[model samples]
Target: MKFLVDAQLPVRLARFLESAGYDTIHTKDLPHKNATSDTEINSISIRDNRIVITKDSDFLNSFLTIKEPYKLLLITTGNINNLELEAIFAANLQFLSELFVSHSYIEMTRDSIIVHY
Candidate 1:
């Protein structure tokens, strides 16, 4: 699966996904870097067919209200270090990949993965 990592997330997460053999890009790689607007991010997500992996609730709102960005992986694991976050992804990567095949909105908390219709 392809992914677009948002600014609030560490670029290493994107790198990790890449290392795991998925096509991924971080907001820092964009023209405006982390300053890239959410609208632009959404456009890129739609254009590239990338699932947006973000901690931003705004993305959650957009996904619920308008179904933009094609798909979303919302990170709700609050205030953790990058390594901890990466570990979470590492542990759940396979299930996550499978979930995205049929699910468009998924939320990752410290303890669980919640799939939303």
Candidate 2:
């Protein structure tokens, strides 16, 4: 599935996703960059059919409360460097790649991915 990597995540994640063959974009590419509002991000995700990969709990709140984005991959890996974070995603490629097809929300830690509906 396609993905939109939020500002809190390093832009490297977006590059990694693209190299892995999934359509992906980082918030840095948007006009507002880090200042982009959640509402606008949601709108973009909806318009583009992109799942949001974010470290922000606000996205989780929006999803739980009102289902804002098309889907979510909430990174709960906690303050990790880009290389390690990229490693976790790469190692979990099979799961991460297929996750959005059947799940709307997923919490991903360094060790495991938990699907939440």
Query: How does each model score on lDDT?
Result: 0.96, 0.91
lDDT of 1: 0.96
Tell me the spans in candidate 1 whose CA falls farther than 4 Å from its real position.
none
lDDT of 1 by residue, 46-83 (tens): 99999999999999889889989889999999999989
Candidate 2 stretches with Cα past 4 Å from truth are none
Choose the strongest candidate by TM-score: 1
- Candidate 2 C-alpha error for residue 43, in Å: 0.4
In terms of lDDT, the poorest run of 10 residues in model 2 is 93-102
